[model samples]
Target: MTPTITDAPDRAEAAALLHAVADPARLAVIRRLADSPACVCDLQEQVPIALSLLSYHLKVLRAADLVTSRRRGRWLDYSLTPDALERLHAALPAPPPRHPGPTAGAGEAATPQPYTAACPPQCADQIQ
Candidate 1:
């Protein structure tokens, strides 16, 4: 279904969230956090990006409310927000039904449906 006027804000928010994780480095950080909360140093080791670049990615995730950080002495630990999965799911448009409707007569070909955009395969599995 096409989005209505009221969906504009939702669509914008979803775009922001998706854009935040569009980067490979940010995705790596999210994947690592999904396993367990980790310090910035740990994320650096896992992602192999420069500390400044890592910080930039983390800042984007934090801005989108997908990630949270807690200070432990001089280091900071990052983790996914409690509602991260739910928020991601809500942001995505619901997929169209897999099968054609009963309107198709026996032995008749079903009408072709329009293509619908969805999360990329790499991101889809992680979110679900």
Candidate 2:
């Protein structure tokens, strides 16, 4: 079922999601899944964790909706849900706005200006 977030309580749901992905192991699992769908065994190999431990982490990720799993024969293949990444991306803080600094010829204390050459221009008469 699609989760609609038209109400304020839904923000808790978003926070739960962020909490789930905050784990380093879970983050690694998401990165691995981003490349290709993998079974638990594949996840174990990629992450170097015990099978039981990996299973627990996968459960957490699944509960947070960051990943989905489907049984293929005897193996459960795992993949990242695009929506989860989108939600996390939306929660990120925006970059700060840039302020314009002083420019040349503005007369500000910090303004940059080029120094003129000390040599004077020579006319033919002056040269003679």
Candidate 3:
């Protein structure tokens, strides 16, 4: 989806989200959630990080809305928020288009003769 400037979380909020995922360990946690939701114990198995560290990372993620947790018996299950992820992607500048220049060439037999069309009114080089 196109990302309007207002489409993202506020700058401060966005910064918070970026900071939450800044840690390498926490980033891995997000990646894991990308595949499937997991409880603390299940994440521990996948992350191989210390319990305290994992908890801290999860706290960061929760605060940023990147993840949501629910009580499941004694465990808290966490899942990714796809909208948050999309907002993150939208906030970042898009990569430039793959092909940027004129495609036609002199040696290309299928190339049409150069012809100028009426430029949009706002175009600086618009024909009179």
Q: Which candidate is the best by lDDT?
A: 1
Best-to-worst order by TM-score is 1, 3, 2
lDDT of 1 by residue, 1-128 (tens): 34322377888988888788889999888889989999999999999988999999999999999999999999999999987766776777777655645798766657775443586777766664
Better of 1 and 2 by lDDT: 1
TM-score of each: 0.71, 0.66, 0.70
Decoy 2 TM-score against native: 0.66
lDDT of 3 by residue, 2-65 (tens): 6644544466565676787889888889989999999999999989989998998898888888
Error of 2 at 110 (Å): 14
Q: After superposition, how far is residue 91 of candidate 1 from its true place, in Å?
A: 1.7
Cα RMSD of predicted structure 3 = 8.9
lDDT of each: 0.84, 0.76, 0.77
The local distance difference test score of model 1 is: 0.84
> Which structure among the candidates has the greatest TM-score?
1
* Inter-residue clash pairs, candidate 1: none
lDDT of each residue in 8-104, candidate 2, tens digit only: 6666776787788788888899889988889888888889988888899999998888899999999999999878767666545445444445553
Better of 2 and 3 by TM-score: 3
Off by over 4 Å in 2: 1-10, 99-128
